[model samples]
Target: MKINIPETDQERIVIVGGGFGGLTLARKLAKSNYQIVLIDRNNFHQFQPLFYQVAMAGLEPSSILFPLRKTFHRYDNVYIRVAEVTGIKLAEKRLETSLGICNFDHLIIATGADTNFFGNQQIADKAIPMKSVSEALFLRNTILNDYEIALSTTDFDDRQGYIDIVIVGGGPTGVEVAGALAEMRKNVLPKDYPELDCSEIDIYLVQSSPQLLKGMSEAASEKALEFLTELGVKVILNNRVVSYDGEFVEMKDGSRIQSRKVIWAAGITGSLIPGLPEGSVTYGNRLKVNRYNEVEGVDNVYALGDIAYMEEEEYPQGHPQVAQVAIQQAKQLADNFKKRAAGKEMKEFSYRDLGSMATIGRRLAVVDLPNWKFQGTFAWFVWLFVHLFAILGSRNKLVVFINWVWNYLFYDQSLRLIIRTGAPWKKMDDVIDEGERG
Candidate 1:
């Protein structure tokens, strides 16, 4: 089926995925002469960095999401489609998606990444991943439901299982989650569930690496560990999860932790579509791209964000899979497209390291810059300010700021209402099936 895009003499630039990278590219190309078609599985662009905040009830899901249509309403050159790309037919210069096949002159794959289970299907099925708004809300519902179940259960051991939270992979997500849970245990749980013994609720953060926040400096890692420990979270490093059977997680050292809730933040791999050469994928299932973000061996086909592995002299292994890299690459690609349209030589892509920061909890965060390193309350303030400014919509920023201030003053999460009607997986499957049937 032919897509209902506007008939234009300008070249059609198709971008798959509306995450940080795709949205940035689209916005940058808004003023250009190229006709742009942006497709994504979801209608909203999720601010993934604050997903834990939503799960922890610190922020609402709406605060971390911006409607795709709303974002591009003022741009006449761009069109938006809410559909999942199924495959890419390189020979035909077409993409097969949920809506239908659409031809494009240039294709940009910004499909981003998904939670990595590291080849463990059992863990993948059972563990909760925080990658999207729906997933975060589902986690929030499950956490509340588990607490309710804990309160209802007469057996002490069963209650412990319900209340205990185990977060695997002490990266930013895991650390933030553990810290949030610790805060809940210390401040919120006591007030909310007064009958339940908050002390019995355990929060454990398991890291396979030697230290938490391995991407950051040693000082940052050390500070993060200290912050988590001070919040009453147990940090277990140099250990890997061997298996999880829904009730307990077994470690490689023949140890085990009993918990019903397991949040997996261990790793991520590119979420790729079919029809690309199978061998083109590298480590982490990322598509290997050239200096100009063009897919290797496929002209007019490019990739960016977590899905693209562009090796450079400074980053021989490929750049870090962060939102900043994706945004920068997208902007660069947009500029290149404009330059090519004007019959100018295209510029090579180079990432600018703008530093990294991770917040542990209220008044606790770490920031790493080229010449500066800091931690604690000031870092936390910087983290908040940067994130607030980074969010797409003004309404989102205001809502998030209000929520953060409310959470700080009251020590309570107002949006902790369990809205799940049935089993989470069953509901998700039903939705997918409905879409297929439609």
Candidate 2:
């Protein structure tokens, strides 16, 4: 079954991917003359910034995700389709989706980014990436499964393999995951696994950069590193991960770390859909776009969010792959569409830097604004408020807030159920054997 959107004789604007950018554009274009058809792989729009919370069991996956149909219920011109966009036929102004072929007057590709394994198929197949809701649920399950395995095992080294969590990449996602895992070790694990020593649980954040939060200020980076260390996370800087064989992560320096849970938050590339000119893609696997966010050499096709790279004087290397940039670009593009329809002059898109912020744990965070930089409790509060307001649904906000408060006051995370749909014994055995050998 499909959610039918009324198609008027007006120009139909087809948006691929109901991520931050696409959703923002759709909301802005609500009640406009143009007909909007938004297609995504999933029906719900996810709040990606807080995915770590879902993985760490600090928040429910449903709390951070809202149904796309609910967001556009009031807009008669907007429609959402739960289908995977297979390829773009730019020459014919059509897109091939799982449902069928759909033609569009203007096509907007806002498919966002995916984890970049950098030509390593082994890592891609083995490591867990927290880029989507399903992936986060898998991580949550995997983490809980490790503890359950530890409870059953009598061997010390075998138990250590279950407890050791090596997070690849020291970026925001990595640091947040590390901090959350550290909190679990400090506050929750001891209570849950009293038979086993919680101290054996190791949380490591590995980064190739000289410091954590490379995109943020120095003070923020230092404060985050300090916070992570205080939480018992081993902060490894200027270190490169050469390989991982599902169980052991081997460093470039020839050192191997045994870990069953290796979360890959290292890098992300533009989630490119098929049918675009192969050479038109640029750095970070993004499609090269003109000033108006139009795909290079394609007139009717446009790209935004993490998939589009608009290299300007201010942003020579393209805008940072952040929600703010995506939302801002979408807003501008929506206005441009209106102006184009009215035969008015179009405006060149420019991004306003709203700065970056990351939360470490309860009461530990960092914020970098245009004129101000702060760390600690106030920054943490700022981080909380901003994210709460940014989330799509009021119910989602309430659920997340209550969960956060409960976690903060009690120092306990309750979502630790290991609900396995099917037995993955073969995969688990292979991972365990690999870890033992390493």
Among the numbered candidates, top TM-score falls to 1
* Candidate 1 global CA lDDT score: 0.89
The digit string of per-residue lDDT tens for model 1 on 321-413 reads 999999999999999999998999999999999999999988999999878999999999999999999998989989989888888898888
Error of 2 at 42 (Å): 0.3
Q: Estimated TM-score per prediction?
A: 0.96, 0.95
For candidate 1, the 10 contiguous residues with the lowest summed lDDT are 429-438
Q: What is the lDDT of residue 204 in candidate 2?
A: 86
lDDT of 2 by residue, 1-438 (tens): 223455579899999989999999988888689999999999999999989988888888899998989988787788788999888887788888888888899999999999999989988877889899878877887888788788988988778888899999998999999988988888898998898788888888999989999999999999999999999899889888888887688998888898877899999999999998887799989999988999997778889999999988989999999999889999999999989989999999988998899999879999999999999999999999999999888899898888888888999987887554344454666754543211
lDDT of 2: 0.88
Task: Report how far off residue 44 is in candidate 2 (Å).
Answer: 0.6
Clashing pairs in 2: none
